[model samples]
Target chain A: MAGYGTARQDHLRRLRRIEGQTRGLQRMVDDDKYCIDILTQVSAVTSALQSFALSLLEEHLAHCVAEATRNGGPEAQEKIKEASDAIGRLVRS
Target chain B: MAGYGTARQDHLRRLRRIEGQTRGLQRMVDDDKYCIDILTQVSAVTSALQSFALSLLEEHLAHCVAEATRNGGPEAQEKIKEASDAIGRLVRS
Candidate 1:
C-alpha cells in the first residue's frame, strides 16, 4: 500500500489526462504546428504533470511521512531523508 | 514549415518516448509502487519532457528566429517577442 492510496483514483484520472495531452502533442508535431504554438502546448502538458506530482507528494507526506514520524523511530529519519531527496529531484527536474 | 523542420522527426521520436513514459507512470501507480519510487519516475519523465522542450526551442531559435532577425524588419521584432514569451512560459511551467 502506498501513501497515495486515498488519492489513487484521482491520480489515475490525472495520468489519463496527461496521456491525452501527450497524444495531443504528437498530433501537433505531426500536423506541422507552429513552433511557438507547439511550445505552448508542451508547457501546458508540463504544468499538468507538475500539478499531478505535487498532489502525489502531498499525499505521500500526509500518509507515509506522517505515519513514520508518528511512530518515532529510525524509520522516521529515513523517511524524511527520502522525502527530501524526492523533493530535490522534483525541483531540479 | 516551422523552425523545427529538420528536427521534426526527432521531436516526434522524443514525444513518442514521453508518451511511453507517461504510460509507465500509470502502470506504476496502478501496481501499488512505493511512493518514493513513483515520485522518482515522475521526475525522470518530467526531465525528459524538459529536454524535449529545450531542444525544440533551440531549433526554433536557430531556424525561425534566426531567419526573421536576418530579414531586419518589423516581423523580426515580432518573432523575437513571440519567442521570448514562449521561453517565459517554459520557465514558469
Candidate 2:
C-alpha cells in the first residue's frame, strides 16, 4: 500500500504521465503519424509502466512482505506466495 | 498510419481504455489497495498495451510494408529495418 502522502503523490504523478503518453498515442494515430513512430511511443509507455510496477513490487516486498516474514506465521507464507504470483504475472505479461 | 475513419476510431478507443486502466491504477494507489492487486492491474494494463501494439504492427505490415515490398526498392528494406527495430524495442521494453 502506497498511501503515505509523499508516496501517493509520486504514484499519482507517474500515472498522470503515463496517461498523458496514452493520449499522445491517440493523437499520433489521429494524425496518421508513421507506424514505426507510434510503435516507438507505445514501447516507451509500456516500459514506463513496467518500471513503475517493478518499483511498486520492490516497495511491497520491503514493507508488507518483510513485515510478514518477520512475524513468522502462516500469514508470512501467504504473503510470500501472493508476492510470487504477482511477480509471475508481471514477467509473463 | 491509422488515419482512416474506422481504423483511427478503433485505435483511439483502445488507447482510451488503456488510459482508463492507468487512471484506475492511480485510484488503487490513492485508496491504499493491496500491493498484489495493484500489481495485477499494472500487468493487465501492460498486456493491453502490448496486444494493442501487436495489432497495430500487424496492420503496418499488411499495409505500408506490404506496399513497399510490392514496389521492390530500397524503401522496402528501409521499412523492414524500421519495423524490426520497433519490434526489438517492444520486446526489450
Whose TM-score is greatest here?
1
Q: Per-residue CA lDDT of candidate 1, range A1-93, in tens?
A: 898888889999999999999989899888889888988988898889889989888988999999999999899999999999999998988
**Backbone-clash count (model 2):** 0
In order, what fnat does every candidate score? 0.86, 0.86
Give a tens-digit lDDT track for model 1, residues B1-93.
Answer: 887877889999999999999999999999999988988988888888889899999989998889989998999999999999999998988
Q: Fill in the DockQ of model 2.
A: 0.70
Off by over 4 Å in 1: none
lDDT of 2 by residue, A1-93 (tens): 342334777778989999999999989888888888899999899989988888788888888888989998999999999999999998998
DockQ of each: 0.86, 0.70
* Residue pairs in candidate 2 whose N, alpha carbon or C atoms collide under 3 angstroms: none
The model with the greatest lDDT is: 1
TM-score of chain B of 1: 0.93
> Residue B93 deviation, candidate 2, in Å?
1.0
Provide C-alpha RMSD values for all models, in order.
Answer: 0.9, 1.7
